[model samples]
Target: MAKLQLITPNVAYEQDYKAFYQDWQDSGRAIIPSVAKDLPADFAGYVQRLNDNAQGIGLEEGIVPNSTFWLVNEENNEVLGAVNIRHQLTPYLERVGGHIGFGLRPTARGKGYAKTMLALSLKEAKSLELEKVLITCDVDNVTSEKTILKNGGRRSTDEQTEEGIIVHRFWIDL
Candidate 1:
């Protein structure tokens, strides 16, 4: 185990960005939605895009303002995973999507990083003044369910979206 910390994406993390992206591609997991879309192959462009996203400078329609963080192992400065925290929820979010979205690299799975990263994200959500945050995971993602529960998440409801995916929703009090 290593001491981990969350840091906002920046130019300094280009190498980490590449490595993380490669791992996701290799694993064939559905890409991490917003963070995956518009990721540039070029380093500079990617940093600029991430910066704009964090500042809400230029976002597509229906996308909410969010803060993205990478969980880094402080000892060797390797990226373990990433998380996105929405500032507030829209109607769509209330129904399905949630306040936090997180994923650890395939190589990092089952090492308890998800729970740790999620706990850290919850603190960040609290710092943003969120009294309680909504978090949801696919019905089959047991690891995510456990992480949410470990972080004080209480299951609130389950939804079957038009797309036919069963999503389990939970709320965590700050």
Candidate 2:
């Protein structure tokens, strides 16, 4: 089984963050928000983005630490996928962003990593006293939809984002 590690932002991973952002962008996948190549190079902007994203959702406190989790092959420490849980939820989050955000890296697309990562995240969310959590994915992302449903996510409704993207929302009660 693959081991998943929840990581906090720190110096050791400063470069790893850059690399993951770069690799994901280069792989031509739609995961992290698109950043200008130069923005990642700008340390402050990069750090701020990361913090803002986590903080914006209240993932910064209550023993949760508002962090990101990396799914890895325990045997080799190979990074596969990641899921980030926010400490708090917002209106937008309720509609789409959800309480947890996850994605399978290009190299590990499939193999049930996404589902496992989310299941683990849900456990953590429950630990923080979250009775239920909302998770959303693009309507077209069948793989992610299935992963969520497999984790006991019940279908809610498709909401249209202000950006015009249709997002499928699911609610998972602990």
Candidate 3:
């Protein structure tokens, strides 16, 4: 495999994002882009939303400032995953959003793309002056929890939300 490349949202996909969308769709599974913000009701809906933001085809509001997003690609330039990182933490963010989020496209899971993307994003966060970074994953999301731990994340605490979702919090010291 060629070296993986991670680029910001502004330079995420220079080619066809549709191709990446199609690849994921064809696989019958899709990994949520942590950087994509709110996930739509489902995958199909989310793809529509992704294209809209990707192509500037449409727009969304309240994106955090100084936040950077990226697409992870293969040597062939095929997008294998995506990630998002914020330069600073906010109130609600400190509890939930954390300092970063990430995911691997469905078709690309188990290939360690999310891990690579995350490590790369952490480096970027350090560049942005983050001394320690916080990341959270749903308690049941073993895959994500492992991903967090794989990136030097230590278990922080568990949070129970009003909506009832249990989140496992972790922090990485850069």
Per-model TM against the reference: 0.92, 0.74, 0.74
lDDT of every predicted structure (CA atoms): 0.83, 0.67, 0.68
Candidate 1 off by > 4 Å: none
Best by lDDT, which number?
Answer: 1
Local error of candidate 2 at 21, Å?
Answer: 3.5
Q: What is the overall TM-score of model 2 with all chains considered together?
A: 0.74
lDDT of 3 by residue, 1-174 (tens): 448876654333534455555666666664455444333345455554444443444544544544445555555767666676756667777887787877766767787777878898888888878899998887788999998899999998567453588777899999
The digit string of per-residue lDDT tens for model 1 on 1-174 reads 889999988778778767887888888777664575345868777667666876787888988888888899988778878888988999998888899998888888888898999999999998888999999988888988999999999998566463787899999999
- Overall local distance difference test of candidate 3: 0.68
Q: On TM-score, who's better, 1 or 3?
A: 1
- Best-to-worst lDDT order: 1, 3, 2
Worst 10 residues of 3 by lDDT: 8-17
